[model samples]
Target: MYVSARERKLLERLLADDRDITVGELAEELNVSARTVHRDLQGLESVFRRYGLKLAKRAGVGIRLVGEEENKQALAAELFRLSHHEYTPEERQLMILIALLEANEPVKLVTLAHDLNVTVATVSLDLDKLEQTVEAYGLSLIRKRGYGVELAGSESAKRRLMSDLLFRHVDEHEFLALMKETIQKRADAPLDTVAEKLLGLVDRKKLAIIEQQIEQVKEKLPFTMADSSYIAFVVHLALAMERIKRGEAIHFDPRDLQALQATKEYEIAHELAESLEKVFDVDIPNEEVGYMTMHLMGAKWRNRQGTMMEEPSLTVGMKAQQLIRSVSDKLGVDLSTDRTLYEDLVVHLKPALYRLEHGMGVANPLLDQIKQDYAELFAIVADGARQLFGDIPIPDEEIGYLVLHFAAALMREKKGWRVLVICSSGLGTAKILAMRLKKEIPDIVSLEQASAFEWKGKDVSAYDLVISTVPLPEEYGPHIVVSPMLTEEEARKIREHLERKTSAAKRMEKEPTARRNKPIIDTMKAVRRISETIVHILDGFSLEVVKRRSVHEILTDACRRLERSGVIVDADVVVEELRRRESLGGLGVPGTTLALYHARSFAVLRPSLTMYRLDSPQTVAGMDGEPMEINTVVLLLGPADADEEVLSVLSHVSTLLVKDEQSAATLAYGGEDEVYSLISGHLEQFFDDYWISMKE
Candidate 1:
């Protein structure tokens, strides 16, 4: 059986972890489909048997490699040796740049073409973009007829560019392993050799020593450096030896040298240089020590527990603010107020500007990858930097780092689904269901339990999904009806059902195609129908005027009051998660003071929603320092594990909160019996209007 490069990766992954891994987990890790994994496993079975291994799979339990460790290790080694021959256009360009930058002598275009397995014309065309990439690193691709091609620039700049190019793909561990293996045996017994080795044919012992020196310097530093900055140090330290052996020299402005020497990073660098001087039996330069200081200046602290920073100097903070403002205005996402994003940007930009001003081309080997991954984000950062710095072209590499700050702010770090379990056999059965669901599915954020009879009248809309032993016919989205001791096939069925429902909800607003007679497929009517099922949860709806106070206090008080009704279990957990959500970003609606405070918790028995009208306008912090004041708040609570139906209603309700806040509030606070009547009546009307608008 022949294996493809991708199949090899699959075998590697299965062999790497001894524990069983679900198809979904494998698909996610390898960035492929579950079906693809299943097919690959079939192809792999025959191949694995030759290695004295078997692909062990159990229903609902995932797959694992069952065999001796030695066989698995040998098989893994063979997988790594296979050449990844196929290359994207971007990959080809990066490969050309790597060969040129690392070449000790001027490498011919023909040689690069042969290495990449491409024609000379294609290789030449790749160099056009490659030149622009290298030019950013303060190096020029100088082609001399017959002599071939060489990178021409300052020796220091060449090393920076080389450092960036060397570790573009792999992390520190992989790079070091390759370095160690290639070094410890370069002159001894050899394996099959590729034309251009990734780790380079450098002195392994020297490379290892440099790596240790860098680790030492990094640990001793006051501030934590960015991953990119650390990579630069490794490459710089390793290449410094190479350049020095070739009798290369470095010089810096005397004043700049004095300034760098005064810093702790420079002092550390000075000691490293002294150690290298003794190891290599050669004098080290002061200019190289200055370069190391610059690397330390751009680092982030490893331990930033509440210690963000005592305010940076006015100019530095202002520069960062200027860039953030530009991004907000142009991109329309105001990240200017995220305390962490702001601080990170300020610290990074100051050192970056210092480097750029001194004509240091900070090589970003990941520039191409970053641009490819976050193209829109990179553009926004570039445009914003353009406005902030005027004509000082900030390298694409620098822009990539800036994008990371905003990217962190934009990242929604959610772990998994908050699940509610409903069982006909009561608490014992419910707990059993929770354990079964958790074992097969690792994505259960929190597992809460309730008897079907107990949960029927409680507010349960707060949970992401509900798992029940038996179906009791609730219109709250979709619920998984599973056996108390779930089977693997049944678990997969549940996952499939949930995925379809989640996909359908996402597609609802997108494909609003009028299927004239099929109102069941129509999202608007689906929402109305689902919303009506929870009407019982909002029974005896009456609005009491809330006095002005913290929204947390108001919500917590409501939870306690509902606890007397035997609707909630743990009020403390629900309230704390709500507060944590608020801290990440305010839930307060803009324009109207309607803050939608909804939480998912095991405490919630069933889906419940109600509105409270405050007597006076309560001011809450809104986005970008805008004071948000609202007289009405709609508090929605669902089962600790909310289902698709509840999620769909929450989606529609979120839309309603933004659009009809005042009207919804007035209708709610108007009359008690009339409130429920008015809401039920309005749903049909809202559905009709929304459907018509969607059609048009």
Candidate 2:
């Protein structure tokens, strides 16, 4: 929320240039150290990433924002609107005319006249206005006498003209309204020009009727002003009327009679009927009954005589009752004949009826209350209890019923649910893991696959659960780790975990102290630890050994280890980024070499050594298209943030490896001790660079 002034300036620069910038250049421009520039880039990248943007870097090319075209357009649009007051309406109109002309061929005066429905003389006058406006904006407006006007000017002039004419004149609300109208008009139109297309969707007949209704209402009420809200109310009522005619439930809000006491009686009735239809699925025809109800309420609100303390009676005659009964029968709901039952039903129906009559709100609150009070009666009348069930089951059952119930409850409580599936490798085994987990979890809205390390670094708070096959990072989410075989015991344990979590969540709601509170990540870590402990007991494999293997090797091993481990499974997990990185550069490094190894069960890493040593070391391209040398090699094991973390470390390592001085110093120390220290120091720097690139 609080962007630094420097970041703000950087954003402006990007917006203006529409290109990526290098850290070196930014440092020079900002008159800051390269380190500071790198930090700033990281901060910026973090902010943008939260908004679904990616900051990409090429080893020597610098940083650029990937997938932010739409964001830039939106920002440009906002800037234009803020500067709109500088242009007059006439100038704006002329500018649009010029743009249209420039887009078309031949510059036909007749076509222009026809487009605006104006005479040729008027078109000429508009062209003159356009020329004057263009000149003021530092642009040249050329008239070909025979051809139409064309803008021939500097790019800056063109940009200024476009910014003022297109972006500046349209505010968000106006834009939304225009877009809605355009889309309504041309439903089949491409999405590029939504606002324009919507205008074409409006039905002429419906629009005329709406206008007529509005006029009539104005005469009766006499106090309502014609504002955008009122216009929207009228449009929605018109649309709702059409929907109701087609037996559709109206979804629009109705005008408030109390707020629009000055509107005419007929308009009030129309608005109220629309509101009622939307709220209660009742289609009341335009009848005297509706008019009378509106008259009563309109009169009360107009006189300011109705108190909040007073409850208005909404009793209808036997004829109206019979009509209601007919509707209920049509809807397949039984209607009680007893006077008291009928009276109570009428009480529930009154608000809707009143709204139908007076352009008042017909919200379902009163009906909901009535249903709660006489649920049994209403249930039978509304139709068999089956109506309540539909596709959803009753709340208390186990299996599918409980799942649906939990899903709905969670949706209501959290607004929605997101999930992440953590698994090793990017190919066969990870996919199988995801598929198996998906079968067990029904409420997952989104599922992303990555290794434990990648999942831990990324934000996981949005996910409800993390189901993994291998030991994950020290922290992740509510985890359910299963073996490759996915035995019956594993299934049972998973179910138990879900049940326990569900029960605990319910208990927490009822009694706050029922369970100790812990951060979600901590809980996930505990779950992982527990799952791993059980796995080790069953399989006799140390979790630490599992963790030490690279993601590539983990996947490769999962496939091969399956035959011996009695885990009959096909682990064909292919690390896409690994291959992609190889395509970009190559994963080989000097002295120590990293190669992607594959087997039957899962993908794994196999680090090997080349016996030959180089006398004069030279740079070789690594997985990031960067130069590297033979001293050290880091094989990116799997698709765990391969593009980000792995590639970043490789880039930094390449930088050090390619340096003759650093390599000589490293070689002098010789053993693993010297190599480890050199690599570790560089790793820290690499991490810093990685963070910086991310921010950028």
Candidate 3:
């Protein structure tokens, strides 16, 4: 049975809340006026009656669903089953827009109305709403009494609109499943949802081929691409291929094309285009390659340490600094010294500005939730962006990404439990989830992020908890599914899950012999591994005065010291890697007179930490992308294939360096014994925690 989205919502609410709910409450919950609620409720009775239930309204008290529990459950089942295609007014309007955009010729309003299961008048009103939206993309909606309705615009604008719709409606998991053809369809499944219709814009067979081609060349790119970005790239190629086949051409400014050709992304794009020509047997244009290059540059996600500031643009860096200052002034927080925030903003805004100027847009599925969850922060960020980037018309999607960078910086913390955050985008939303968990819950020592595509075959046992934005298979173990924004209720659910795990662990402790499937030797080995790593680091740790005057010289001296101490097999190779890492970005910790030079290289034999005090201070770029004076150099190194425990311990030490002013002071000026004691104390506490986990 078919049901209006509103009626279905009202019915679901009534069914969920066994107690009577007033009309005012329902209206408020649904964000509608009481009159609208009454109108929606008018036909809900018939919908409920289909499953043998009744909607009873009292004279003065309120309204309630009166029926057998089984009947109510049956009605709920039906509602859930039909929810996919029961489009709301907004969804219906979106579908109509997609239909018009996808059409080659004018389509009859009756046909659209019939397809949407709405009246012709409703379709007309929807077109009215969509006119402004289309015009925003430099497109116009054409409607005539006899000629029917069609979208009139350049092929480029239409393609952009189509891409925007797909990104907004077809979620990441759904896009992957659709491309892989893994979306199982039931016999009664309806294939007319707004998302499904948007996906229809691309030919599935061609999409799969495009995906395969991208997979082959994706690793050749310099930086990692977020999963959502990967999906967008694939969709763009598929759409471009389809349009090229239809004899439509896309244009790129000749001057802009010249500038893009100098970029590495352009070269990669050109290579991919050549392969497409060979496979698809179509002539590809330089403009298409230029556009693809822009997509690659804009969608880049940094994968390695210190790479965020490579060949940084002075203009974008200053803009990032100014934006941070603006937000700091508005929020009354001193974020100007946050080096990580500054560098992240620089990296994000560099391409972000490009996308906006070129009329490229990305979809943020969590935009609404981000606005709802961080309303005040959103306004502040919006104000900051307006002041820093005047008249750029930055979309909320981009603003949402900015908010995540600031939010993660604000909520940054260090505690003692490991968590893995699996997300679809593996960029903005995932950062929000990780920071929110650290802020709301205690003892999350470290959090690792992976894309939904990367979750397969992961060592789940390494994490204290696995939380995913998308649902995982049952074989992956009990992971809590949550929204990217991580609503308060979802946070509460995660807290409960952790509490239950802790309780069970304690129970196991109480019964020593129960469930002894875990071998004693295995537990002892974990203990030994953690202990050995801690001891090795402490044994090699040293605080000495050095006469090196430059960053390169100081790093050389530090590497030689590590080499002599047998912590690294080769100092020269390690020095070169550290120097290369330094060139990418600043190693100096903000608000401290120390720089952390860290790397994971084959030259390092074990995890080690050492501090070198310079006789005279030297100027170097700070992590915040600003120059700062440093009198101390802190070196942290680990093997390329370090154990999880070893990595965690080294990460803990890194956090301790800038943990606070006192820790920084101690590290910079403290004597050798004092420094060793400080690090050992923290590591000892970490070991104690690790020991407990192993025992459990």
- Considering every candidate listed, which one attains the maximal TM-score? 3
Residue 674 local lDDT, model 1: 64
Which candidate do you rate higher for TM-score, 1 or 2?
A: 1
Compared to the true structure, candidate 2 yields what TM-score?
A: 0.25
- Preferred candidate (lDDT higher): 1 or 2: 1
* Candidate 1's TM-score: 0.45
lDDT (Cα) of model 3: 0.77
lDDT tens digits, residue span 1-696, model 1 = 347656766786787566678999989877889999999888887888899999888899877888886898788767656556645466577667667656678999899888777898888788777888877767788886787888778777766666555555443445534334443665343322222344553444576677666665555665554434554566566677777777776667789788677566787888878877877787777887787677666443323221211112223455666677777777777775454455556566666776776665564444564576568988888887877787577877778767756654565232455567875432223444565566667665556565553455544455556777655555644577666656555688767765655745634532332233234456565555455634644462446667765667788888777777766777787778677656645555555556667666788876666677777777775532366776776676666555555544443333344324355454435665665665555555545544553343
RMSD, one per candidate, in order: 19.7, 33.3, 8.0
TM-score per prediction, in order, is: 0.45, 0.25, 0.66
Candidate 2 displacement at residue 115 in angstroms: 7.6
Show model 3 residue runs off by greater than 4 Å.
9-32, 35-88, 113-122, 184-190, 300-309, 312-315, 487-489, 503-696
Model 3, 1-696: lDDT tens per residue?
A: 766677776877887655567899999888899999998888666776677877777877788887887888788766655645457777888888877766779999999888877789988998999889999999998889989998987878888888888877666767877666675343135555566677777777677777778777878887778777788888889899988887778877899899788777998999999989988999999988988898898884745333322334334655676678778888888886565676577667877887888888767777887898789999999888977788688989899989989987787655456688998875787888887898889677667788877787576666667899887779778798886767565788778777777756744543353224345786777678788889888988888787746768777877887788788999999988888777667777777788888888999999888788889999988876799999888888889777666766776577566445576788988898988888999788878767755554
Q: Which stretches of candidate 2 lie over 4 Å from their true place?
A: 1-94, 97-103, 109-143, 150-169, 172-580, 585-602, 605-616, 622-631, 639-671, 674-696
Q: Rate the local accuracy (lDDT) of all candidates.
A: 0.62, 0.40, 0.77
